[model samples]
Target: MGLLDNLKARLAPAKGKVSHLAHEHGHKVTHGLDRAAKAVDEKTKGKYSDRIHTGTDKAKGAVDRLAHKDEPPAGGGDTFTPPRTPPPAS
Candidate 1:
């Protein structure tokens, strides 16, 4: 293997262990993200409320993606969650 591949090989086991830990404690990690965002928002007096919400959403999505990586896109075993469309106007 090339130097890069050899390095990756050596790191694979550690990576796997870290991944497992993250999966097990994913909710706690998400909570910490929420707390940090709240702290920033309070420190700035809600000046960045919009951006904070956006960032929080993106972060939550990422956490969800990783937490569900082993399951098919849909845990229901459908392999996907169809994008929902808005209801037609009355």
Candidate 2:
């Protein structure tokens, strides 16, 4: 295999382990993210509150994605449809 392929092969196991850990300790990870964000915001005296909030949200999203990587998609993979569409009113 090429260099890139070999690297991917080796890292596959580590990636699986990380996904598992993220799933198991996802709550702790999210809590830590919040705590760190709060500390930084306090240190900056709220000057970067917006940016810090955005970063914290993104980090939490990433953690959730990793933790649920193996789960089925939201809505159970079903296409959504609007309910009770009004009949054509002439």
Candidate 3:
């Protein structure tokens, strides 16, 4: 009945459709991310390996969540998993 509710109702279907599309195209998204990371790493000659890898992993995990959101995720959705942080240097 309210403006926000009405807008949400109208866009709900669109949201689901987009999620489905993302799920279907997950592989391509993944490949693109990898390629970009490799290129960046090569340009930087492995100087940023740890940071780049962490970022790439987080990005891939986000894609996985978006793609598998409609159905039960391998670990289920909205589980609030923590991001991977680097270990403290000895």
For model 3, name the residue pairs that clash: none
After superposing candidate 2, which stretches have Cα over 4 Å from the reference?
73-90
User: Which residue window of length 10 is worst by lDDT in model 1?
Assistant: 66-75
For each candidate in turn, the TM-score is 0.62, 0.75, 0.61
Error of 3 at 15 (Å): 2.6
Stronger candidate by TM-score (2 vs 3): 2
- Per-prediction tally of clashes: 0, 0, 0
Question: In order, what is each prediction's RMSD in angstroms?
Answer: 8.3, 4.1, 12.2
What ranking of all candidate models by lDDT puts the best one first? 2, 3, 1
Give the per-residue lDDT of model 3 (tens digit) for 1-90. 999999999999998787787899988988999999999999999999889999999988888777775465476666877769977889
Candidate 1 residue pairs that clash: none
TM-score leader: 2
Better TM-score candidate (1, 3): 1
Candidate 2: the clashing residue pairs are none
lDDT of each model, Cα atoms only?
Answer: 0.82, 0.90, 0.86
